[model samples]
Structures are given as structure tokens and as C-alpha cells.
Target: MAGGKTINSVFRRLAEEETIRRVQTGLYDYPRYSELLDRTLGPDIFQVASALARKFKWEIQPDGASALNLMGLSTQVPAQYLFHSDGPTREYQINRTKLRFKRVATREMKFKQPESAVIVHGLKSLGPDHINDKTIAKVRDWLPEAKRRQVLRDTQTVTQWVRAAIREICKEPVHG
Candidate 1:
């Protein structure tokens, strides 16, 4: 901790002993293991991103693709875990996977409800043409009761079309 050399030496020893794993420069975690799977499991991408955002005092949200994936609206795995933040753009490689943070407008980073933000971003990734009745039903089924209610309540702050789409997804039977 006294100097870069000392820190590197300490980290290297810890890694070699499997006491801790390096995530990225100056970041480390105690690795998690699944006995049933008989393999190591990586840290949750969103949790890692949230930690980094807090460390740097930045507002952050998952980007469209990441949001879709996070909400189980998309089955495709992303090559990179992406987030939009008000901080400067940056990238990190953790356990051979890329984590990217792209700078975005202050307004885009603000959301009063987490479910609304995730649903909006996930719907944006699907696009209007892809969001049919079946898609809306899937999203509705995927969301828990409380989150469904919250998304409906939070729709007031979103744009007209987005609010309508969210209302439809929540199965409110009326868009207002």
C-alpha cells in the first residue's frame, strides 16, 4: 500500500493463493463458487457497475441491450456489459469480459423508479415494431406484482408513447 510496487506484490500474492481475485486495476473480489455447478461464478455485472458508480459518485443506468438482458426480456448474452453514466466514458475488462460505461446526458440518468427505467430501456431495445401483444404479455408476466404496479405509477413522468406502452405492458386496460 505504500507504493505501486508494494500494492502489486500484495495483490499478486493474494491472487496466487486464491484468497481474492482481480476484477480490474485496483479492484478485487472474493471469488464465489457454486458447489452444484462445480465451477466459479463471476460477480453480478450490475452489482459491480453499481459499486464502481458509487465509488466515483456517478449516476448510472444499464444501456438498452444491458437493460433488456437484465430484465429477462432478451435471451442473447452481450459481449460487453454496458452502462450509461453521467461520468466520462471508460472501459474495463473483468474475468475476460468487457465492462463499458458511456457518458450520457444528465436527464437520461435520472429516473424516480428503477422498474420504469429498466422497462423503458428494455422496450426501446425491442423497438415499436417488435413490441407486439405477445411481447407485452411476456414483460407483464416477467414483472412481479409490486414492480408492475410501480411501473404503472411511474409512467406519468415518461413520454406519451412510452407511457402508453408501459400501461399496455402492465395490462392496465387503459392508457392515460
Candidate 2:
């Protein structure tokens, strides 16, 4: 394993050269410049969370609100990007926004991909009573064919109603 001092030294030099921007203590990103916006874009919160999970060797999934926001199912911008993880619960501040990891059951982290996590969590957030054909169709249309198929396969063992909703979302269009 690399020494913490050695890693910190490298990061300090990189930050000094502006090769990377520090999101918070121990988290850094190669800042993305947006020509359209004429400025450096903020670090992507999802990418930041993923980086933390990888660094800590944690299995992570976006929680309901975060997942809904990711899928465009919710219009409200989350003040905190919340994730359920096998790691200890913690919070990190990224500028005005916050990133949180809440420890959850292992079963919840079974999704094979982030896309699958988003679909499942988003549907769960909506709840059985709130979901309708329109919502299902919206989710179906939002995902590409490949992702729809993958998400369908990954969520087979999820909660029955959520699984049912995923089936509807991922079902292929029938031709007459």
C-alpha cells in the first residue's frame, strides 16, 4: 500500500500546479472546463461519490432521492447527494452541496451497475401507489434499449412491486 504521506505529497504538488482541483480533504478531480459556460465546471457529485467508494473499497448505491434525481424523475435538485454503502455512514461537503453515505443492508447493494441502482431506487421512491403507466413509460423512454435490458436483468430479485415496475419499464414494445 502507498504511504499516506507519499499520496498527500503528490496531491499537494498536483493541486499547486492546478492539474487537479480539491473537492474536499483527500478528494480531488481533474477540473472540467466548459467553453459554453466559460468557466471550470463543478466536480460531478456522482463521480466524486464513486471515487470515494473506490478509495474506501465500499459497495455503494444511490439512495431514493439521489436515484430519482439521476433519472430525471425528480425536478428538485438534491441538496445532498445521498448514497447507501457498505462503508460507515459519513458526510462530505462539496462546495454548497453535500455528499452523504449512509450504511445500509448488503442486499440493497446487489445492483451490478449504477443504472440498475438508479431505476430501482427511483421506482422505490415513487412507491407502488404513486407509479402509473405514464411514469413507467417515462422511465422506459428515458433509458436506452441496452440499459433497459441490463437493468431488467439486474433487478430480478428486488422487492416484488419494484420488480414488477421494472418489468414494465424494461419491456420491449410489441409490434402488431
Candidate 3:
């Protein structure tokens, strides 16, 4: 009638406009995020750790022994990240990796990871005996040479706590 457009066409346009508004405003549910999860899970351990930490709502630092293993300096395997969290217990089994998520005492919390990055930190996370001067020298080459001296200088301070902890954990004699 008004320029020859029909009333039925006007009403149909209005209905589509409402549906578009609802979808844009999040009135519809999409399961596509699960596909994202499926794509990221299992093969990517660190990604899974990050996702799991958020899923459980915790503060996490994937360093210590975890970094050492990823660095190829340690032959031993890590059982967990020793995540110092204010959250409850959570255990994530990502393929062969076992990540432990548990509550930590406030005093034990860390603000900065020693190795900076997760993979680097895992390489340095070994027991006291496992991190000898030779082992340290071997792993040092992996870092930029400029950083090696500083990392070596920090080793005494770095492994001090780890050495003490391993001794206490094993309840046995300690070695360098």
C-alpha cells in the first residue's frame, strides 16, 4: 500500500529484527565453546593447566620442578605444579601429565616465578641431588649466555629451599 510493500513483508521483517537483537544480546546459547575446549585439551598441558585453574578459580604458578622437566634437565617426572592456591582440591589428568591443585599456606605463596616462563621454570624444578654443578652447567646453555651467569648466581638462593624441601620429603641424607 505505501510504496507497494505488503503488510505481511513488514511484519516478517520486524520478527527477524527481534530475533537478531536477541542473538546479539546473548539471548541464545551456543555450544561452540565446547569445540574450542575439545581442540585445546589433552595435547596442550600448559593450556589445560591454565584453563583448569580458571575453571576452579585459583591462583597458579606453574614453576619449580615443572619447569625443570620441560627444560630437559631432569630425568624424573613431576607429579604436580605445587600450585599454591586459596581454592579447594582439584586434580587434572591431561593425558600422561598429572597436575595437582590444592590449597597452600599464605606464607608459601609466590608472586614471581624463578624461571619466569612455565617451560623454563619446569626445567629447573628438580630435587637437590638432581641439580649438581654439572647439571646446572648443562642446563645453563639452554638459556641465552648473558642470562647464564645471573641464573648461576641465583642458583644458591634458588635451590636452597628446594634442597631443604627434598631432604625433608625423603627424610633421608642430603647431597649437593
Candidate 4:
């Protein structure tokens, strides 16, 4: 429609008809239903966040705990999914699950490779003491060959200690 009034009217109609479910103000989705489970299934939080980021023209990356969870390094599912962005801070709740976006400096959001960024965040979440040889091996094993190479190539932009850890993780064994 040409104006907010027209758009709101259309949205109201669709919502009333159950064709769309309102997640929050200005956010909506086609509600997913699990027939076997007999309950509503929540939308993929990452996909929802990505759509919002694109719609608002914001650059975002999964933050700390969220990064660890996305990388399978963390087994516990977080109640809130967090992201860092160059845009204003905002929060949204979808089906009782929370999505939080915290604003940060542009430089903080820069990374040559997304996989490297996730690994760095995950390592930071684990802290120095926890990121030993076994942790390095686990992370290396978790990543595919291409992503392992990319992480190695992208380590230059990270901190010295982090780069060292990444180097060790990427090191190839010498055969006798």
C-alpha cells in the first residue's frame, strides 16, 4: 500500500484470517505447526534475525554464547539469542524466545571470514584456560577442510594469542 494506514489494514486482515501470526510490532510469520508433537513450532531464530537484518539494512554477527551454540561448541540452548551489529540495539520476542541485538563499533564487527569470526567468539566464550590443545583439536575437527583453511588465512586480523591458537589448530602433522 501507499501508506502505513493501508499496510496496517492489510496486515490486520491477514492476521485475523490466521494467514500470518504477529511476532511483534512490524514482525510477522506464517506460524509453523507440528502435527505429531501437537504444538506450535518456533521459527528458526537465526533465519528470523537474518531477515530482520536484511530488511533494516543492518550488518550483524552472532555474539559470544550464540556463536558457541551455533558452532556446536556449547550444548546448552540459550533462552536468548544474541547478536552484535553496527545498528541500534533492539530486542524481539518470538513465541517466548528472545532475540537481542546489541550495537557495537563498526570495527568490532569486521572479519574477513564468518567462520573465523564464529571460532574466535566461541574461543573467547570458553576463555584462555579452557582453550587448550584438546579444545583446539575439537574445533579443528568440527570445521570442514575448507573452513579450516579459511580460518587459518583469516587469523591475521585477530589478536596475537588467538592467532597463535588458530595456527596450532591448523598445523598439519608431518609424516615420517
Q: Cα lDDT of all candidates, in order? A: 0.81, 0.88, 0.48, 0.82
lDDT of 2 at 35: 100
Give per-residue CA lDDT, model 1, range 16-67, as digits (tens).
9999987766777888899999998987788789889988998888888998
- On a 0 to 100 scale, what is the lDDT of residue 88 in model 1? 94
> Among these predicted structures, which one has the highest TM-score?
2
Candidate 3 C-alpha lDDT tens digits along 1-176: 35435754554566466432112111221212257456422234555566666766677655566556655666576655555466776775544667776677654443343343332345344544565555545454445545443444343343455534322322322458
- What residue runs in model 2 are displaced by over 4 Å at the alpha carbon? 1-19, 33-39, 174-176
Per-residue error for 101 in candidate 3, Å, reads 0.9
Encode model 2's per-residue lDDT on 116-158: one tens digit a residue.
Answer: 8888888888899999988888888788888887887888889
- State the lDDT at 60 in candidate 2: 91
Pick out the ten consecutive residues of candidate 3 with the lowest summed lDDT.
21-30
- List the candidates' TM-scores in order: 0.76, 0.79, 0.44, 0.73
Model 3, CA-based lDDT: 0.48
Q: Tell me the tens digit of each residue's lDDT in model 4 across 61-84.
A: 898898888777787878999998
Candidate 4, residue 21: lDDT? 80
Model 1: per-residue Cα lDDT at residue 41: 91
Q: Give me the runs in candidate 3 sitting further than 4 Å from their true place.
A: 1-42, 54-57, 63-65, 75-82, 114-127, 142-176
